[model samples]
Target: MGSSKAPSWSDQWGTGGLGSDNYEYEEGDKLKKSSSSNKMSSAKAAASAGMDKAKSAALVSADKAKSAAVVGAQKVKTGTFAGLKWFKNQYQKRSSK
Candidate 1:
């Protein structure tokens, strides 16, 4: 038997190797994905769903923030314009005396 290299991190994690090197199958051999791969894909889908939820929540928060900012700015602008109008009226009344 050929002397094999010492098992590295893959052996420690029981994943065989960094990539799908062990998963590759030669032609004419019956090959099918392992249940572990299926589990991994399902986990990936769950992670994606969570990420999508986060993304939607962030978008909702941004929209709310934008709405609040626009409402606040409108209030400030309206108040400033009205105050200026009142000031002009007061000055006119005093000068016309």
Candidate 2:
């Protein structure tokens, strides 16, 4: 008759053994998932910061444009008054002549 022997723990656990290839594969998969989430969070934060900077730049540009427009309007008002004075003096001279 053939001899009988008990199976070892590794034989019983088969692919699910603690130090087996399956265990390492599962651990690697978990690590990959964690790293992927970390990268996504980092990307989102960078995008948010970029948007804030763009908004601040746009607000500054708008303020500068408003100031320029006010200055231009003041110049136009001054020029118009000077022209009116010159026209009045010419008219007076013509009448006297």
Best by TM-score: 1
Model 2 C-alpha lDDT versus the unseen true structure: 0.70
Candidate 2 lDDT over 1-97, as tens digits, reads: 2543433456446554444333333332321112346666888899999999999999999999999999999999999999999999999999999
Tell me the TM-score of model 2: 0.58
Candidate 1 regions exceeding 4 Å error are: 1-36
lDDT of all predictions? 0.74, 0.70
TM-scores of the candidates are: 0.60, 0.58
Q: Tens digits of per-residue lDDT for model 1 on 1-97?
A: 3555543455434555435544533365423344487778888999999999999999999999999999999999999999999999999999999
Instruction: Name the candidate that leads on lDDT.
Output: 1
TM-score of model 1 vs. true structure:
0.60
Clash count, one per candidate: 0, 0
Model 1 alpha-carbon miss at residue 4, Å:
20
